[model samples]
Target: MSKPSGKSMDEIVALCRRRGFIFQSSEIYGGINGFWDYGPLGTELKRNLKNAWWEDVVLREMVGPDGKTIEMVGLDSTIIMHPKVWEASGHVAGFNDPMVGCKTEGCKRLFRADKVFMVDLGLDPSGKHVDVGVEADSKAKAEELAIGIAKRFKIRHDANPNPIAFSVLEEFAEIPTDMQRFPCPNCQHRTLTPPRPFNLMFESHSGPIQSDDNKVYLRPETAQGIFVNFLNVVNTTRVGVPFGIAQQGKAFRNEVTPRNFTFRSREFEQMEIEFFIHPSTAKEWYAFWRDNRFAWWQSVGLTSANLQLREHEKDELAHYAKEGAGTSDIEYRFPFTAPGFGELEGVAHRSDYDLRQHAEHSGLRDKMKYFDQERNEKYFPHVIEPSAGADRGTLALICEAYTPDPSRPSGVYMKFHPRMAPVKAAVFPLVNKEGMPEVAEKLYRELRKKWVVDYDPKQSIGKRYARMDEAGTPYCLTIDGQTLKDNTVTVRYRDTLQQERIGIDRVGEFLGQKIGSAQV
Candidate 1:
């Protein structure tokens, strides 16, 4: 079954901007494409998400398929590394996307070749039905093509025999040599250039002199850092084979088209695990990680039908996983891709390719082998990697939490999981007098030491509850008139809008029960 987010991308983006969740980078200067800035709320939400992942994967005690405890360690690698690192990882030579450019005068624009589709506009001229094709890279662009054609032909919007009736002709794997037949999406003219390779890595100079010798590139992934340091980890730690190295850090990629908010940004964060295991047990470990990672996402509040697990096809395998058991993806059905899913995470069986490549390139082939004491043999251990995008996962959580209702003043409330909510609880005074403020402030001070709690006594009780609901605060403790007499407070629940009076001393225990401990 497929679950569609009743919300639209426009609504989600608007909420992000209005509620201080996210903002476009350099927005005052018309903003830069493929970049974004997270606001205070967004930063807290992302930090909580990353912390949850780290605690679950690295700090928590995990069991392997053999019923033994798994060993996992953490690493923080630099964003800029030795230039030779990219050479060994195949990013320097093979990380290229097929690109095509529109040559229309004063309107040049580039697009990924495979993403450009040719659509038949079905324009009839002189009683003969003629197929007029236009190029577009998205559904919005296709709608623009239809409107442009309607205006050019002086056809009314309500006319029968619509001139804009059309369907996709084909997607261009590569623009043909005779590219004049295809029209430009912007200029609506036959001016698209042939396809060519465009590298996605960002380049820079490492020294004072700007020359080829001092040139460097940003690390495109965090996995290579783990692979290059595998020997150091094995030597310094007590972990044997069947161990894993986990990392969470920033990664860079100059995406040609960074659309769908932060989904395809040029800069992002990744939570990746590279598990080293015996070559003979690669299949079992691969299946275990695939299922384990899927369940982890569900445990963190992705319990809707929008989440799914899909196995990769033969052609979909990455360069390193071709000789292994294959790759599986945990995908989410976002608002933009409703009824169709987008990749949230991937669990791949990367057969000793990384270690082998790094060892061969660094001339440490003999030292890179792992000695199995049980089998009394030395060999390169196979890898099972579970890579997840921090930014993408945070966005999915936000998309899943957005709930609209006509009965409330704010019309919508964020239904974030108690463990994942930015503000765990809010304390409000029914009115700003009669010792209620003192009581609420004391409670706020105490709770803030344990979890993120808000204190808002400047507004009406209903308004305060509305604000906290929008912020996804699970519980709200209100010090009402009865608090001073009986020493009890009203606890308002965000999801059901139900309230019940409870002892003032039990507030801490109440929050602890609803949400988890403050450690994560």
Candidate 2:
């Protein structure tokens, strides 16, 4: 029989749950939206991804255009910094998503209007698709498009006996504000409230006071925490200018609509690096970091064919980078949207804006610069930040690795890179008896000392192999009747399904060589 190809997002989600990779946050009591918990396999897959990013991208040394190599240091900053941190970073005023809700009595669902409209109009909402080139002009044309789309479209309404025709949807495309202006997407009634700035930061009261006196917000991005600690890292580590501070941690945003599984979530983790460089050197550094970041994503098993380098238009640039810096996004070909792609990471050139803002707001304005020891002059360092979401990265890896199970056309498997597989190796016995179980168990125990190995003596060898493939186990070692006569086991490869005989004593070394390392 012929093998299958790729899988759908819905299929991936189902497989994740079935294989103990991910689960909804509180299944018993009606689970929360925009939040999910990583199960055992999901956790390993995520951990390996984060470690790979850190090892290959963040912590590595890089040479600048001037041929000077710079080293990067890692930081684990607080999830909640000083309340003024938000004000300094512009998160308080700028970190907002436009939200519109249905005015229907019971189906009052809120959604990110731009995203929904793109989907409704058969447009892909990725940074590389709906948000680039012509998308640069979309800010001025969204209302026009919504108007055009509505002229011929009719949708059901809560009050009207029939669907509303040519309903007004201006509110959905209008600029961000605190007004209700569009029709409810659910009920065709012109019941959508005005577009409002929904600040995404999760807020809380610090200390004993529960008032504005101690108001603070959970860190919405990991970069700010790294920005504020520039002085500490430079001083303690003896790091010089043009260096970077990397961080990976949890961030919070009360998303209006957190659809697409873990791709967008209210509580998520971020892996970010704020690379400091001279203002005159920002362009070179930007290109360098951008290319390196792009390559790293591909190295993590995302196919190059499906990745895109989406440069930000002048209009798409963030407020801090618009004046003097460049910005772009690395988008991936996801399966959910029509275009099958979306933004996975953002690479931006943020001039001294961040450090400048932090200094002025935190009473450290003069303290955020670096001294050129050779020139004996001090200047505020511009930054080229490559920021990525951990959840999205994990999802992208899952998407890239997922394939249909060949044995069962309807079933699926993960063709994860050897280094990226959750369980490194799976051990199985051809049959439950015939001393096969003892050999498989012995090999499994020995391999577990060096790798995350799975042991199974139940079911037929074919079924066990199918389960291992689904879980993305790169190698499957089967101890069969032949193993009783000789100390060799049949090692089946997950990606190719090729089998070869290897001595039981050499299984560890065999896998270590195939996977590049023991994985321990």
Candidate 3:
């Protein structure tokens, strides 16, 4: 099928709010800066996405690289851990971002140094484009600045009248210290300060006494929790090397700027797997996961055109992954990063760095090693980590499923996969009279027992279908006058709009066949 032209972020955000998908946090109190709350539909959609991941990664058995069944296990870890855990994991000392603050009198906005870009404003006295720099936090903001400058100066170019093209001159960090004074993004003055290292972790006191002794931090990633419990899992379960520990939980990062809706939220959830393997098999396992994860996203409905798997370069490798095979990222072309792409998930080969660190810091060096009875040797197992952002995946799904069609009653409909749709099927009565409501209500109650179904007795049949379309409901079953005699109802497919007559008693089987095992 041909892909539809991309939709703007504004359109997607408006649909989300109108359909009760997502909402700003604490809107009554003017809202928080870097947080969001998922509404009923959004909550169900997210839950379905996470459940699908858990089922596919942990519960289902798959063939390994050696053509044998691989073992997988699940874990649920706490959000807060011992402070030393962070120290061992290198987060306490080095989990920082280069931050710069605007020194303008009325605007003291903070920004990540690398995120700040310098763009050409094309404002020159001689009617020629100059290289004078204007700073902005993102490419979108940079384009906005270009338009604002053009309007302010009333400069029009005959060759290209639509605001001369602008490109990022350089990053804030690349500028020399002597010439670091750039215009602030907010106030548009040369009052920005030099970049400094700022920790991204959120800190709090564990007890009533607010002191350094009881200082604690919210976890910044879910991978560490799996690492800390490596030995416990090995000892408790009958699994050996070449197994994985999967986890899904909340993680917090105090981002300097969270502008891309839920894409860069300060608080979010993650689906991570720390797959342990023999040192000799690190390369093979890394390749397996990189290919496997890329396919998994496509199976869940992300199109191949918008999804890509990119291998990291030497300079881009993380500290722990430097000695390993390498790391690969699965990127999605979000509306904000349309021409380009943003990171959706990363598959990295961590060469026993986490296990070694936790072992040394916790004074359990021997306990952290895995015993290989076949080889009669014990050592720290190498890990292949597949870490994905749950919120980012949810956002990607919403963006991909949005389809605009003027032929439909609703201008736009969410073309979600049957397994991923928030509402599996919606039930409606053809009319209010002739006992159609009774039949529709009974069908709705029966389907709701096993799936998330909707029943609407009000409004016209066309309007009900439109509402379901916006909600991303895959199938709509309507009871007409013929149903009272024939015991059959019309099942209207959401995507094709084709209808088929099926017995009312066989509705559950029809949904089960269409939705697969996603049903309750």
Candidate 4:
């Protein structure tokens, strides 16, 4: 299927508001940056997205090698864990974004250094297009990307020398600079200060003691919690190597700047899985999870053309994705993201770094090893993590599903897969009278018990169907005089606009068959 052209963030935000999908958090108090609240429709879609993920990753067993199947277990860990846990996982020190603040008076907004460089180059603030160093560590690679961007954008040291754009960009890439300054992208003034490290974790005090000694942190990623409980899960579930622990929960990040609506929120939900496997099989399992996740997104209705796998360059691999553990991202063509694409999820081979970290830090190294009865080997299982943002996933779906139908004036409808649609179907009485309402109401009530159904009796059947279409309802059932005569009704499919007549008694069966288990 051909993918729809990019939809502006403004247009999407407007639709979300008009349709009650999402809203600004605390909007009455001028709203909060990097925070948002999902409305009725948005909440339903997000919930359904996570539920679908759980069903696929944990509940449903998948065929494995030699026709064997792997069944995953689910996990729900606490949001705030031990402070030492952060120290072990590396979030306490390294989970940061280089921040460069505008030094110009009256404008002191901090910008992520790479994003600033992107804007300086007359492009989207996402740096997905400019590949600086694939094999370099984060800071060094950022610096390299800055230099390449400087040269490409022709940010001449002589022409815009005083702009200090290149200098500021380079400095921020490596370290927060207190020495050099640059022009502010927003103010166009030379009020940019040297970059500084801003830790993303949200820290809090424990036991009413506001001191570092009593500090705890809201998790920035869901992976650590799973790692921390690896032993517990094994002991309790009797699951061994090659199993997964899937979780969906809220994570917090003190983002430098939250732009593009809910794409970069400070508080967001994540659906992640930490799949454990024998160390020797890390790469193989990595590829398996990578392709599996990519295919799963397509199965849920994202277009294949708009989705691509981006291998992490050797230089830019994650600190943990080392020594045979590889990493890659599934990128989607989000209109506002840089170069027209952004990461929807990441699949990483973490090389047992996390488990090793926890073992060493918690002083349980010897006891932390997993005993594989099948192989008679005791070892720390390497991990392949597939982590995605629930909110971002929904946004990607919304962007992909927003289709324009030229058959109607000002026509646009969400072409969601029935599985992801918030409202699955709508029931409309052909008219307000002639016993049609009686039959429609009965069908509506019955379908409501089975699906997220809606009933429309006020407007003409045509308008009602249109409204349901905009809401992404997959099927609309209309009851007219035919239903009173032969107990058959018209069923209109959303994407095709094709109609089929079936017995009223068989509507449930027809929908169940069309929707299928996953679609339902």
TM-score for each predicted model, relative to the true structure: 0.83, 0.80, 0.82, 0.83
Lowest-lDDT window of 10 residues in candidate 3? 160-169
Cα lDDT, model 2, residue 283: 85
lDDT of 1 by residue, 1-520 (tens): 3345788778889988988888999999999898889997788788888989998899888899989999999988888888888998999876665667888779798866655554444434545433333455564566557656646745334323433323222344443655666656556566778777788898888988899998788888899999999999999999999999999999999887899999999999999999999989999899999999998888888889989999999988987888898799999999988889889999999999989998999999878999989889999999999999999999999899999887999898989889888999999999999899999999999999999899999967888888887788889999999999998999999999999999999999988888873331
Q: What would the per-residue lDDT of candidate 4 be over residues 1-520, giving only the tens digit for each residue? A: 2224645666777888988999999999999889999999988898888888988888776875425687588889999999899999988877665667776678777676555642223332442322221112344444455545556544443332222123344544555453233445555455566666778899898887688789889999888989999999999987878888999999999876788888889999999999899987876788888888888888788864777788888777877886666788988887676356788899988888999999999999979999999999999998899999888899988888887686953377888988889998888899989999999999999988988888888976778877876788899999988889999999898888899999999989987886664521
Error of 2 at 474 (Å): 1.3
Q: Which pairs clash inside model 1?
A: none
Error of 2 at 352 (Å): 1.0
lDDT of each: 0.84, 0.76, 0.85, 0.78
- Clashing residue pairs in candidate 3, if any? none
Q: Number of clashing residue pairs in every model?
A: 0, 7, 0, 12
| Candidate 3 TM-score over all chains jointly | 0.82
Model 2: lDDT of residue 188: 47
**Lowest lDDT 10-residue stretch of candidate 4:** 127-136
Q: How many steric clashes does model 2 contain?
A: 7
Clashing pairs in 2: 171-181, 171-182, 179-194, 180-193, 180-194, 181-193, 181-194
